[model samples]
Target: MLSTIATTIPRRALCVRTLPISQTRYASHGTPHYNEPSGYLFGEKPLPQGQKRKREDWELLWYYGMFGSMALAAVGLYYKPDTRYAMAFIPQLLTALIIFNPASKLGH
Candidate 1:
């Protein structure tokens, strides 16, 4: 039935008409203003070339605290007279290493 109907219509009528090219570009409805790049990273300007971004004091403290706690936990677990603690330490260390690795390579 669809084939018969399609055959009755001329090929020109079946073809879709192309829309006229718009000469003036304008933002569509909903957005009131068009945004242009201000060359900023996260609202702040990016660092000059060849300059490394310094870590904040709190970031250093956080990194130290996380690793220090993990190390202390591993030492405690290792010294405890149980096979389970020994078994758990391996996975805990591996998990910490996996999770912590990405933070070191964040800017690259």
Candidate 2:
């Protein structure tokens, strides 16, 4: 019964049909070459290569103020009691010490 059922199914019916496509396709738009600009851009000339513009007085003052503020803030944070490592750990250690105090009369 299995052989008769298999023979009834056509081998050609199992094949898939594919559409025929051309070998080459091209778009109808866009240039094949690039257009290069010939002059300085936007009329603002840049400084010559390997040369840096001198810093203005205001720029120097700004740099000093910014770095000075950062240094002062760092020093302030360093001296702050709450920011100290030992200070942060003191509260937790004190709680534990109070609960386990050797001088307590509750137990030996």
Candidate 3:
């Protein structure tokens, strides 16, 4: 009975088959290939146009201006020996020192 049942199934009906895919002649021709080297010398990415420099030129100018004024005040006190000019030098000197300190965050 088992031998008769096995022989009853057809070989082609039990077999699995894959479907064929349709191909176009223009498909391989239109694909782009980029195997050439790009013209960059250093291999570095380009900087954005909107990016600006971190340092401010005006901050250095302000520091130097305060320093120069302080020196002038000290000289004036030496020449005139007046209490008013000497008092003026005090604030100028403090300002100059504060601006020149490395730990100060004025420029940053």
lDDT of each: 0.76, 0.72, 0.71
Q: Report RMSD (Å) for each prediction in the order shown.
A: 18.6, 12.2, 21.6
The segments of candidate 1 whose C-alpha lies over 4 angstroms from its true place after superposition are 1-46, 83-108
lDDT of 1 by residue, 1-108 (tens): 999788878775759786779765666566656566677865667889999888777998899999999999999988978566587577678667785453366567
> Candidate 3 overall Cα lDDT vs. reference?
0.71
- Candidates 2 and 3: which is better by TM-score? 2
Candidate no. 2 TM-score: 0.34
Q: C-alpha displacement of 24 in model 3, angstroms?
A: 64
TM-scores for candidates 1 onward, in order: 0.34, 0.34, 0.25
For model 2, give the 10-residue run with minimal summed lDDT.
28-37
Highest lDDT, which number? Answer: 1
Candidate 2, pairs of clashing residues: none
Tens digit of lDDT per residue, candidate 2, span 1-108? 998778767554556575568654466346645545557674446789998867667998899999999999999988877655687777678778686454567754
Model 1, position 23: C-alpha lDDT score: 64
